[model samples]
Target chain A: MTSEQPDWIAVDWGTSHVRAWAMTNAGKIIAENGSAKGMGSLAKDEFEPALLELVEPWLSAQTTVVACGMVGARQGWKEAPYAEVPCLPFDGKTTKVETHDSRLDVHLLSGLSQMKPADVMRGEETQIAGFIAAEPDFDGVVCLPGTHTKWARISAKEVVSFQTFMSGELFACLSNHSVLRHSVAGKAWNDETFETAINDAISHPEKLAGRLFSLRADSLLHDLGNAEARARLSGLLIGAEIAAARPYWLGMDIAIIGADTLSGLYSRALELQGCAPRCPDAENLTLAGLAAAYLTLKETSS
Target chain B: MTSEQPDWIAVDWGTSHVRAWAMTNAGKIIAENGSAKGMGSLAKDEFEPALLELVEPWLSAQTTVVACGMVGARQGWKEAPYAEVPCLPFDGKTTKVETHDSRLDVHLLSGLSQMKPADVMRGEETQIAGFIAAEPDFDGVVCLPGTHTKWARISAKEVVSFQTFMSGELFACLSNHSVLRHSVAGKAWNDETFETAINDAISHPEKLAGRLFSLRADSLLHDLGNAEARARLSGLLIGAEIAAARPYWLGMDIAIIGADTLSGLYSRALELQGCAPRCPDAENLTLAGLAAAYLTLKETSS
Candidate 1:
């Protein structure tokens, strides 16, 4: 019942959403689909039956399935052990799960972790590998910005380590839901204000972490324009993260991987941090990571 | 038909809620009456009718009507302009609300304002006065912690100037409501861990803004004990707020105004900042403010 045509599905599952790519052997994405049904939305047993139906057509060709995201954590199937720092993706080991249906070969990737002021990342691992696929054998850090912005150090075929920032989430909360929410002018981006905030934040970086009341007063009393206040808020937070990542990233080459809209903020932040940005098509990169995992599995079995 | 004996009432009026107190001049509170009648619930015109009915019984006697919170704002009735810094209660010229009903000689007191780094406060002006009532008028800073915490520099009867912090609101949104809420430990009051976070945040103060994510990962990766992580998170944020407030508050005596449960956090934070904390009862400080306003009105007319 299987078509001789080979099929591989690559999934970048995250906190809020999931994206799966159907790719050919040469790693060209022929057909694709996505679902709002993110990892957070699913219970442990739901991923298999749900995933099979979406990738069913390609699966008739004996497709191998690969996955990433919180879908790969302790809450995830198989309890993939935390990968230690400076470790590579699929570092000759994978968290393999044999689901209800055996026809699908499923591989869930491992999350990366670091120590003492420690951090870990799950969905970003494949994105890092995908970037590696686009520009093979590249060295440096890959920055992904979001609710949990991620930074990964990559060398050879492995991600040496990475850090995560709850930047996007904090930004959303501070802007819309908190008491300071009413005090700010929302949804408008001004670079001058943003840059000024970044400079002020970097200059008096400690103030970046202070209670947000001064931010409101600055706008109200000091007549800090709304746009500048907004940018300053954004800058103080992002600048603080950059300050933390500096010890790990200084003097290293950096590539920012993610969609254009998603990664633009990180790009601006990189410039402020004296690093140039490289935007990789996240869709293709995830497929590339799946391809790497599938091929690694195939070669090891052979 | 009017009752001659004094009765007690407690009033808690805010932007969204309106309350009235009918009380004896003695500390003991008697009967209380209030309605959904908050400032937001009615138009500006409905205030007179609503307020009259709230304490109709006490109007015939020498009953003193004590009001607190936002009921005395410029928008409430006759606009009360702000008193400048360093002036105590009854010191500044207050704008009186002269209504046709002679029974209600509403003594609208002046709020406080500062010109440099310009800021203004209305209800808190009374709270500051109440705080002063509870303690000797010392040259110090009094912190009123809530959704928007006010840190004021007071000299004698005057609130020289103050800064606002949206600390409580930010903490609520980030903890119980935001996505990061789930990741936070379910424990409270880990002073040791909180102290560590304070030290870490103060040392690399820039990272103070970025330390939130560490709370989640420190637990997930290296088993960062729950209470410690929670405390650390609190310390980091409180430390940052203190750091920012330090510029405005250093060298001034600092007192904290809050109920016991909530004020302890602020006290611990002040301790972290190496500032001894003086906490007076926030009990009916609002009513105390209303009483002060009434007394000032009587003395001024005499």
Candidate 2:
């Protein structure tokens, strides 16, 4: 099997890029490929070519491709309608798109949407599925912090409820576009600054906006160092997010999934709030999710 | 007085623009002028030329130019050292800049600063001065809603203490630069939507970051209108601001000095919170502040 062509490809396609892994029938990663051509950049018809462009070398007859994330969005390759929650993160069925290449059988997984408080998430669901796959009966919270930080409550392998915070986007906008940009220096992290700011914001969430301006005022008047300002800015945003997500994470055993630094930051923030969350690499969870989908699809086909 | 050349000039120089009124010795506006060349755009030396270009026709020998706002900021035309608060908003002993044209005597007014909580206000202090000039015994909170909405405590004709909120800047950043930009349509505003969101935010201020994402989700799932989303965004920000500023405006008489629509929003939000704010035109207040400073300067010179 190692010498032969790969059995399938597992993909995590997001807004800005597509990452695919060639896999053996036994779910081993044979090889990995990626491209900047993501769902955001391509038209509906262009997705097939984009996928083939990245994974063509490893493709063979009946090489199934299971993709997740924005590729299944309404404006993406195909509108894989969302799976409304309080359900298993992965139901083992996905939306399939017609492929021009007969060698490929592509399935795009649907994202999850909540109706009550009104929330939706893409790509992260696959990561959640992967997380559940690892700990089959994991019953608590799984936090995925990224461009949109998600706090999901999982009970007996089902995502009970969740909330999303635009913390990452807010951080980007403030650091790059708002008046705080002047005060916030380069990408530097300070634990003490981050902790203090987080505590201040959490203790007085209403004063968040005022504290944001104080960053600029402090920089101007006290000549606050850029590193501290940058860290404090991150701390403030994350603190507000944690405050909002208290119901989800306060008493729950938690696992955090994302890039190393971000997950670490969330981990530390939660620790300050008295919860120590388990940290997991986001990419691994995404891969595990894609693999689960592919195996389920293979079982159904057989 | 209208026919004769003005005796002096009143200037409100902010980050992006400069507005000036040519005034008689008795504080009557004889003419008005403005230009996009504000403190933000001009270098230190270019400020004089920029000012001259706008009000050059009104200037004659010994015509004193009194300027306020960011023009006196460290990065502005010239640094007018801040006057520590619990003091008068303006002392009239301002930073004087040398001009190539002997016709102008430019006096830049200093802003007010609070050292304890670490806060500062530029153009707003001038507006507060104007508010004071109108009601010499004015005592209470003055709310100035703009890019940086300020809540200033005024008593005995002096600004005692103040705090600044990044509400307006947050609205702009989220609407134009974040993922929420996709859901928010044009510049449409809804009062009912604004009021409801304000109440909701005030009730649960900590959930602000989460509610922000709900606007995006509501658009995705429930087809939240662009107008409603826009208004709700404003409501959420203003709501959080009000909640934080409760201590200042809760039991005190309040006045809102700002642009028409923005001040109206703050006024309505405050009213909902049960404080009926006095709405005063921001420009009028700025003019009155400049006039007061001009009069003080005249008396000192005499």
Best candidate (score: TM-score): 2
What local lDDT score does residue B50 receive in model 1, on the 0 to 100 scale? Answer: 77
- Total clashes in model 1, counting residue pairs 3 or more apart in sequence or in different chains: 17
Question: Residue-wise lDDT of candidate 1 within A142-174, one digit each (tens)?
Answer: 888878888787888677777777777887888
Against the native complex, each candidate's DockQ, computed on alpha carbons, is 0.52, 0.82
lDDT of 1 by residue, B1-302 (tens): 23444443445566566667665656555555677776655666776677777777666643445455555664565556666665674353555555556666455556666666555566666777776776655777888877667788877666666776666676777887565565564865676776776667656667754567877887787776656766776777766677777766677677788768668887876677677888877756767766666655556657
Q: Report the C-alpha lDDT of model 2 over A143-212, residue by residue, as the tens digit.
A: 9999899999998889898899999999999999998888885877788999998998889876787789
Tens digits of lDDT, candidate 2, B1-302: 24579988999999988998998877778899899997888888899889888888886567999999999998987799999988998866788888888999989999988886888889899998988989998889999988898999989988889999999999999999898998886988788999999999899888788899999999999999999999999999999888888888988999999999998898898889888888988888898888888888888888
In candidate 2, the second chain superimposes onto the true chain B with a TM-score of 0.97
Q: Which residue runs of candidate 2 sit more than 4 Å off their true CA positions?
A: A1-4, A60-62, B1-4, B60-62
lDDT of 2: 0.89
